[model samples]
Target: MPKPNKLLIVLAFFSIYVIWGSTYVLNKTAVAELPPFMLAAIRFLTAGVLIFIIAAVTGQNLKISRKQLINTGIAGFLFLAFGNGIVVWALKFVDSGFAALEISAQPLVILLLMWLIQGKKIKPMSLIGVFLGIIGIYLLVNQRQVLNQDDSYIGIIMIFFCMISWAYGSIFVGKADMPSNYFVNTGYQMITGGCMLVLLSLIFNEEWSSPLVWSPNVQLSMILLIIFGSIVAFTSFNYLLKMVSPEKVATNTYVNPIIALFLGWYFLDETVTLQSIIAAVILLSGVYFINTSKRKVMLNRFGLQQIQNKLRKNKVQ
Candidate 1:
């Protein structure tokens, strides 16, 4: 097999960052018309089938051991069932920017989980970053205009729970014995999780007929969700998770929120306040610290005084 190109890796990274970021606005648009769970089910199911067909043609084996299947199911439950499902529902009541603020805390959640479960210590700088992230969240949540716009405290709270679900899902994926083939594992998870979501929509008796009432704009957004958000973004993310550190992969959490914020502003006429800018900067800086601090430590241990030192030297030369 030919080695993967570096450019391809870079493109995948960018794709996940940009595409997933846009999902917040997309979700808001979609749920304006479609039931949240039903939308998620349809998105993932369609993505799963498309990928499955591609896999078949490419001769990618769909077979997985029982243990791997279980792990995939668990990941699906955590990631899709709760992480995504709850966020979609939350959008019915919250602004896309606010939703982005809440979910952007995934890095902090990952850090705390690592400390509690893996016996890892948080570095002081990283701790400062966490503090800043909290401050950012505070600014965002307390914004007076934002509060007046929707005033659904319950929806904000729901997004927090969604953050927790995503955090847990990320930790589970970090520890699970996943299959070697990234696409296969992703496909299995999406299929299982998507089925569960469909079942849930039925159990809740959510009116599937509501979709017919959606505006053409909402319909277009759903198409984007399935094609770009579900299929392209997820596949890129799973591929990166296999190729890079989980910490590195989760950096998208930070990047995505910024993209979502901008998209929300441009498309939804969502206002971006001074507070929003403050919060976004702090949150992303915290994510940077949390994700990269450990790498700096490891590099120091190996006698690399500065991780960026070589790059600087190369540029100077």
Candidate 2:
């Protein structure tokens, strides 16, 4: 196999870091003017269609086995439908800044779910990281403060559900049987989930025309979502996933909250409190430790020593 280009890898990492980081702010703006589910549906629908058309023109096979289609649809429902849908809905009541903070707790949720469902063992230090992340989330939620505020508690709960749904979706996607054409697979999933969202929007009787005066802002955010979040970020993420370890690719989650926080502050005049700063530090630290835990660096060190000793014994004997 040809050696992968280091430059391309670097570029992929940069794109994933920046593009994904900006999506939360974009989502916040989109939801501010659009019916959350309808906005999500439109975003994914346009993105998915454009991607599929491009793939077709490029002569990529869009066909999949029945099993593959089913799996893809299932993943779409979990990840985009529930995961992203709840996020869009939560933005209605939560400040984008606080919403970003809540979403940053996802890494810890994923870790705990992996342990429970897959019977994976976590390292001691990483377990501390999980606890710290939980504390950060507790601070972010501010149940005492939010309970008295109108609809704040409900929004917080919705964001928490968003986190859990995303965690579950990530796991499901990992286990799913994917198609050979990754781009096509992604397109299908987005299209499927987007359609589901549209159906849901109708069921909830969310008036699509309610935010007519906010059209310009909503349109701009939608365009950004389709171009940056769906197209650019997804392509960068898949490229990184193929070229690097999954753990390394997952680092975008940590990077995204930082970008979201800054963008929310700059564009939305969102305040960053001491608690937010503390939460950001603790959250990033927790994500770092949790990601590294998967590698079991401490255990690997012992394994390496054991291998060296075995080699020495063979030589001596």
Candidate 3:
């Protein structure tokens, strides 16, 4: 196989790591001023439209079978509508940094779900990682300050659900039929998910009466979310998935929380207590263990065969 492009990999990493991390802060800011469902709906709808236009202009095939459309729609609803939308709503009660940290436990949750729902065998190290993750979560949630507030616990619970929804959606996407063009597939997902958010907003009667309600900060955040957060970062991630090993691409999960914590503290003046710092370390360490263990399993199972197949394919090409 040919060597990968170092520069493109770096750019893709930057997009997914930095851009996605910063989005937590942006989402927090926007949801503070705008209704969460409405804000998410508009951001995704605008991004979806922009991406769809780009796909069309670039002559990418937009066609999909009915099965592909259904699967894509389901994945979109699970990922965006429940995963992201709930996190945005929960941000009203949670700090952006804390939310990011909590979401970083997604891999562990996914592992557990696969084990329980799919009957996948869990490696010993991965089981340990799961236990550690639970401890970290307990540490974070049981802090004296959090314990004193009912709403904080509510937000934390909501974020937990968000992680589960996101992980399930991610796992589903791997098995489900989708358009061959990643950009077109992403566009459809965004459009379908955005429509779901809009429907929820309407059902809930979210306040959208006046333009004056949206502050300049909220407007700017929304625009950034649509462009950088949704379109650029997501496209970069898709590119990376094709060009690099999934293990390398998964490093973004490690980097993003750190970036989110720093940005939240620097810009938002969010609290970063000693307990929170310790919790972050434990949570991230657990995630590290989980990922490394899973990588080992994957390599043991398919690494050699896949490499041989790839080499043969390259020769044919």
Candidate 4:
């Protein structure tokens, strides 16, 4: 791969750190006015189509084998259609910052999932992370504000399931048959996931509002979500994985929640509670512990490609 300029590298880091964090608020603002599934469907479909066009222009082959297509489809369903789509639905009830904070425990969830599903051993630090993660989640979800709100509990619970789906998808895609090129692979998943989201929207009978009738804020939010959230951030994430060390790329996991919390509070007037602040610290610390513990074992057991894929398992969202 050609070397990216320093400016470009900085911009890529900014995209994954800042723009990715901002996605929660962007989606929250849009989902307030638009059907969640439909909104996701449109965002992904347009992004997917644009990816294919870009691929073609760049002379990248868009073709894949039958098995690869099937695997990508399954990934699409898990990671995007259900994983991200449900989170968008849940955002209607929960604060964007709160959702981002809860999801930041992703490394913890992945660790437990590996232990339970693959029979992998959990090291001592990860075990500590697990304990902290559980406590943090208890504090986060047990809030009076969260429980008092209508359906917020359900939304919070559903977001946990989404985290699981995303984690599993990450593992599966790392080992599964996938396109060699990350761009092509993501495009295929986006298209497949977008189709599934459309199907889900139809099945759920979500009202399909026309873009023409959307409020200006919603229209801008959708544009931002599709362009910056889906495309630009993803491209930056992929680029940085090649240019930087895993630790640097992984810093986004920590920074995203902070950015989201601040943006949500500043933009949408979302409340940041004391308990939630404590939970955020605990949850993010758990993530750090989990990632720190797993680094040596992962490097020894898995090849570089697998490491990259596992790290890339996280979405631009």
Candidate 5:
């Protein structure tokens, strides 16, 4: 009912844009040495437990109804278990930057899903944005030659599905009967998702090397992924969803790929061809259009409302 704090909103945006952007590279690094599902399971479980502890210490209620748990569990399965677990697995074969670029398509997917499920009409400009996004994806994928690499293509497909799963989860959580405490809800999601990942790992017979054998770099990456990526950035994202329009909250798609590309290049020495740069431009431009179009529509509606209010006052007078 109250106005959202501009400062907090900006901070939350930064958290998702910068912190989550960095996570692509961190995830790539961790998955290089760790089993994908197991790594995700551990990272999320640890982050969830720590968040729960923090919530308890801060005097937040941990209670949840069975329905809330079920909803959050479904969200957790979609978001973390499928969305993130697949991304982690894909990072083993795909470049983090390339993966980030693909994942940027999430906004478009979310928009389409919202329109289909909620019967929200897509604006003309938003439709144009979606077209541009599809073109951009075509260009990016063509540049990558993903089909040539058997393993890499599978990874690419997995990331594509990841985007869909994440988009659906993002929209679902908005309507789901979850806890009012964002932290509490996020912790439950993480825990549920992590458990699912662990179950998947067991089903697939994923072998986990002893943590004692992990390289220092892998260890550090895992720590950062758990603390900053899952705990801090994810919580910021969920908080922003509560504070702002989902479209606005999703603008991180525009910023995250840039960060991921730069980090992947600088830290991992990943190649970024000129074609990739062009594709990035095209893709990000589409995302920009999609986000701004909605804002324009909202502003137009507000302006029209003001004009009608003025005319009504004059007639009444």
Candidate 6:
């Protein structure tokens, strides 16, 4: 590969690491003021529309086969509508930092899914990661504060399910037929996922409010989630996956939790217990073990070889 732009690389890495980490706090702030599903729906719907507008204006092909559309839609429902939407809902009960810490175990979840569902063999290093991850999760969840909070365990459980959906979606997207254009594919997933979130909001009868009526904090959080979290961060993510190595990209898994924890404690007055800190250390260490495994294949967001293949065929990387 030709030499990568060092400045662009740094900016891209910063975007994915910090911007994506901050999304947990942003979502927490917004859902406090707006109905969770509605908040997610609007954020995604707006981002999806803007992405499409950008795609069209830039002359990217928007075409897809029926099967590709179905697969992409299913992937979107798994990845965004359910994976992300449910997390937003749970944010009402869970601290944003805690949620970020929990989600950091996604690689562990993916590892087990590969063993159970796909019958893929686990590397020895990954097995150790799984062991540490389990202990970490126990420590993270078995805290007195979390147990004392009303329905917080329920929120934690729901977020666990969200991780499953996210891991499965990653595996699915790795093999499923997607739109050749990565940007266009992302646009479709956003629109489809946003539509599903809207449907969910209606089914649940969530109270909807106009953006005009939101508090300044909620409005700013919403804007940040849509513009930076969804658009800029995702674009940066795809760019980095293509420009650099997946192992380097996977560093975001651990760094995000740290940022979330600090931001939550500083801005939202969320608690960060001593035990929670220990759990984060162990859990993220586990994720590190898995990401650094010599076997370079990815079952979750851990590896992007499959994604890079798709981008190569499209030549959009």
On TM-score, the candidate that comes out on top is 5
Worst 10 residues of 3 by lDDT: 241-250
> Higher-lDDT candidate among 3 and 6?
6
Estimate, for each residue in 220-253, the C-alpha lDDT of model 3 and write its tens digit: 8888999999898877765665565443565677
RMSD of each: 5.0, 3.5, 3.9, 7.7, 1.7, 6.7
Per-model TM-score, in order, reads 0.89, 0.87, 0.88, 0.86, 0.95, 0.87
lDDT for model 3: 0.82
Q: Candidate 6 at 123: error in angstroms?
A: 1.7
lDDT of 2 by residue, 1-317 (tens): 22567997887788778887787888888887678899888888888999899999999999998998898788678768887887889877877777877787777887788789888777787798898888888776764444566788888888888778767766776566767565787788889889999999999998876434567877788888998788777666645554554455667778777888899999988777777778778877888888777667756987999999999999999
What does candidate 4's lDDT look like per residue over 146-231, in tens digits? 89989898899999999889777766765677777767877888899999999999999998978999999999999998889887
TM-score, candidate 6, is 0.87
Q: Write the per-residue lDDT of candidate 1 for residues 206-294, one digit (tens) a residue.
A: 87865467789887888898788877777777677666666677788777878888899999998888878888888888888887797
Query: In lDDT terms, how accurate is model 4?
Result: 0.85
- Model 4 clash pairs? none
Tell me the number of clashing residue pairs for each predicted model: 0, 0, 0, 0, 0, 0
Query: Comparing 3 and 5 by TM-score, which wins?
Result: 5
**Per-residue lDDT of model 5, residues 1-317, tens digit only:** 34788998899999999999999999999888889999999999999999999999999999999999999899889989999998999998789999999989888998999999899998888888899899988888886455565588788888999998988888887777788878998899999999999999999899977778899999999999999999989888888877777788888999899999999999999988887888888888888889889899889999999999999999999
lDDT of the candidates, in the order given: 0.81, 0.78, 0.82, 0.85, 0.89, 0.85
Q: Which of candidates 2 and 4 reaches a greater TM-score?
A: 2
Report lDDT (Cα) of residue 195, candidate 3: 97
TM-score of 4: 0.86
Error of 6 at 135 (Å): 0.6
Best of the two (1, 5) by lDDT = 5
